[model samples]
Target: MEGEHSHKPADIKARLAAGPKASYLRDWVYGGIDGTVTTFAVVAGAIGAEFSTQVLLVLGAANLFADGFSMAAANYTATRAEREDYRRLLEQERRHIRFFPDGERQEIRQIFQNKGFQGEELETLVSLITERKDVWIDTMLAEEYGRSNTQSDPVRSAGATFAAFGLCGALPLAPFVLSIPEAPSAATGLTALVFFAIGSVRSRFSTRSWLRCGLETFAIGLTAAGVAFLAGDLLTRLF
Candidate 1:
């Protein structure tokens, strides 16, 4: 019975350690949407300027590659920096334990007291937590470290984000790349349809209604297209 009881906390900790896949998926979806929206607007604007198809394609391709790499690199560097900061904080905490044991114990006592454990129970809990080096450190981490489970692999997160964004960005422009000489309008219509579908699909990440997601995405895409088209037309007039 004692053994079984002791294992319960370990089991709970194991369950807590499990990664939240939905959160990662949501991040990827958002990244993709951002990339797609920005790129689509730029491409549409360029096309509206009555530039040759070659020029539009070149611009779109450049945007896709540059933006994807930039997002990925930024994610990688940021995650790595955060991880390093966390380690450094942990090391400082360990040093505090070595050099200021009394102060650390007092802090732990206060922490437990604040949690409603008082008198002997609080003393026992504090003693148990401080008895082991690992347990002691973990308590300090929870109470002081303020660390939470987040994406730890900078490279993996970067790769996933870049791939998701690049794929989404390429979808609308694909029609332009594949268009035959006689069917430009058809290609544009097809691209719009794809944009709507991507938006609807992305809504799943937000756990929102498909209709709302679709409409929101449509609004964004339409707004970008409208603004770019007007700008392009204005530029043509000026030049």
Candidate 2:
């Protein structure tokens, strides 16, 4: 039982047992990291360019709304595209099974045979699965095509992505918007925290250490900000 591999903590165990649904947090991490990075990039760039707080506010706010919505729209379209691809493949499988029953059966048998099943067991499995239309199509879809039932909900995914983007993206602009002193520094700190939080939250769906994940995300975001800031500074000096 110790090495059985299914064992997990009580709270997270149920979710993990459920498969890819738990992995939907990918959208959350994706949106959060980008939102913070882009917004902070603007803030850092404005500062490095010796731009006024007003300019920082304007740029950051503009990025937060425009870029956030764009990313969400892209996510929605991409998710829908994936679903459509799956449907297309499933339909193809259906037609294949209908038109060429023997060939389809052979395909199933060959698949299982390659997996080490043969003779009685192989025939039994092939017969059992192919006996039902849905089972047969699903088996081909999964085994042959590597598809799964855990299709992402486009609406939910887009909502999660945009919500995370909006919240995390607001960090860099918060200081300037709120008239905080040392606005640039405040924005940097806030964005860093957001980055760490996004990484930490991502760990919930992965086996990675919370601290390590948090630091990795922080490093990526800060590095991007640093580059943007340096570019702005270089451009400012040149022009």
Question: What's the lDDT for all of these models?
Answer: 0.73, 0.85
In model 2, the runs with Cα more than 4 Å from the true position are: 1-23
- Give the alpha carbon lDDT tens digit for every residue of 162-206 in model 2: 998999899789889889888777888998898888788777656
Candidate 2 local Cα displacement, residue 137, angstroms: 0.9
**17-122, model 1: which lDDT tens digit per residue?**
7744324564475557656765676666676576787887888788888988888898779878977887777788789999998899999999989989999999
* CA displacement after TM-score superposition, residue 4 of candidate 2 (Å): 14
lDDT of 2 at 46: 79
What range of 10 consecutive residues in model 2 has the weakest lDDT sum? 2-11
